[model samples]
Target: MDEEDSQIQKTQLAMTVPTTRVDVLVIGAGQAGLATGYRLAQEGVSFLIVDENQQIGDSWRKRYDSLTLFTPRSLNALPGKVLDGDPDGYPSRDEFADYLANYALHYNLPVQTNFRIASLDIEAEALFWAEGADGSAILARAVVVATGGFQVPVIPEIAGTFSPQVRQLTPETYKGPADVEHGPVVVVGDGASGRDIAFELSAFKSVILSRGRNRRLLPEKLFGISMWKWLKVLGLLRAGPNSPLGRAMRKSDPFPSRERSDRDLEKRGVVLASRLIGANGKRAVFADGSTLDVGAVIWCVGYHDDFTWLMIKAAKDQTGSIVVKDGRSPVPGLFFIGRPWQRNRASALVTGSTADAQRLVDDVEQYLSSTRQGEGSIALVAK
Candidate 1:
């Protein structure tokens, strides 16, 4: 938090004008967006990354301060640089943001902070165009949709109601216990975020609402090798959502267990209640036939995908990810990178995304070469 660093954060925070275009346009400047842009720069591709937020890593920065990534530092790096500070330690929320900003500056990635993409429309000639924040637009011969999966929060619809005095917020907006006004807090959702938040607020009085047992937390390592290493060996990491690993995870009725344990939550007296039935004023009813009075409720239920802003109609499954027919898209010149299992088990990981980016460069090179050939043919016809 030096003076210079502080100033840089401030400059990026200002949400000014928001419109422009470039040869290639990337939406969302999180880990995926920045990684894609950095790789594109190396291949001499004239591209720009635009984010709705005012700065890089805004998504990660907005999370609760106590948050540290589940994965270690070595697994959380981008192309060309490793995360600073502790190479093996899980970075703090802000440290991760700093790492992202540095990654952008290090490579001089052409990222336009605060340039929120309003809508992407296709003009004539099959050009992919995106309308920027102001009203201007960028048209590219190709587009990479790296919006990622963690933008929206999914709040469940429960019965009953709480009084106005009860405070409720999602983990997306939960800063810390200090952010709460006062009193005991009841957190819902047994996912990682739920467990973490419950642990954080336990000292101030807290309870965790477990909807149903899904995944139990396991350490990253079993013996000497990391669990990810074992997963890689078993080919579980490379398995697509249609693969056996993916099918088992998707079909598991309760939920897939977590990779890490919630011992902190359990030790802090965080009650593991069943699904919430309803709320009556200050009392919350649980499926276990129990009731408790809570001063606050925090939901950590995860997110959904919304690609309404993307105008191109490509072949997408129910999840909105472009279906890869042998690592190629139905739309020629349109490519996808940093997607889950786009390549190997590492495709979605930060380090793995770079590998995906390199693969994307191959597609980019072919597309540009084809574009030049098309233009030459048109010139010959005019002659």
Candidate 2:
């Protein structure tokens, strides 16, 4: 077509994709984002939650099929809805995902699914702009980045040394032992993910789990009461970072084992090895100078925060985590929710999102009010 015809088509396409405007823009629709949206809606705030997933709770649905929440149904409930089943029973990953979807629908949360935010920047003195992957955009007075801290999978540098014949996978991508070759499997890292994977794989094939410092194990039930109930009774779950209990809990790793111990894993045919150091040819080397011949390796190390899309470098810290006090970022109008230890030790948990969102929404409303009152521009300084 001629240049004018092409220009007319471009203009029409642009016109069809309208820019959304709101008082606040939430960048995720997970537990954290939905919690904040619920609070914002209750306060009559005009806000929108934008998620990259095609449907609500797709994030949870993407996890391994056998994954079940460590937290029982009672504590796993979102802000308004309790998971509709035996409160004491654990819910599978798919069940939890469905619960999240139902929660969003029950609350009528304003969420735009399949809209991944590509970049965030200050559009003007008092407004922020969020551009989506689909060419749509949002302008708002405040922004809450509710994307949880764990956005990127973290595999160690040694992973590259493995032989091409050996299959490699991260916990995020691993579905089951069927995804690997028929030979032995080596699971790297001693975290909950590694333990769980090793436990499951042992039933099908010979499994070796690379060990680190062992984490404290809490029994699934004590005296016929769930261990979560004990944590709640001891005030450990709700303790703030400044509290003595919180300080102790933060220094400790997550309780990895529920009802199983090292002995139990050994009894189940899971051999515990020293830390995985590197790969030597086709063999997996360990810190103890030993090696294991394996057909596959699964890295359950952990995840890192992915915030490179954010235009403002001043909003992040040296470690790349968003610099925030209590969900309020160093940038005045910018906020972060669903961050680990953002306010309390429980800040990252599903049950903790409500309290974290409540405090964040309070600060967000205050910031909006100040902007409306012609206050000076928010000081966006890195802490």
Per-model lDDT: 0.68, 0.81
The candidate maximizing TM-score is 2
Off by over 4 Å in 2: 1-17, 242-244, 318-320, 374-383
- What TM value does model 1 have? 0.81
lDDT of 1 by residue, 1-383 (tens): 75467445433432332333345666768787787787777767777777787888887888898988755677788877878665556788888888898889888887778876777655545556566667655656677777665668876665237877888888788898887775667777777678778777877765665556555454556685566556657766556666776666444422112322456556668777787778889888888888887788887767776766765566466777556643456877666666655665466567566667767767766776777554521110100
User: 227-306, model 2: which lDDT tens digit per residue?
Assistant: 88788787777888877877777766556366456777899999989989889657998899998778989888889988
Off by over 4 Å in 1: 1-21, 224-226, 229-235, 249-263, 313-330, 339-347, 374-383
Cα TM-score of candidate 2: 0.91
Please report how far candidate 1 places residue 83 from its true position, in Å. Answer: 1.7
lDDT: which candidate is best?
2
How many residue-pair clashes does candidate 2 contain? 0
Q: What is the TM-score of each candidate against the true structure?
A: 0.81, 0.91
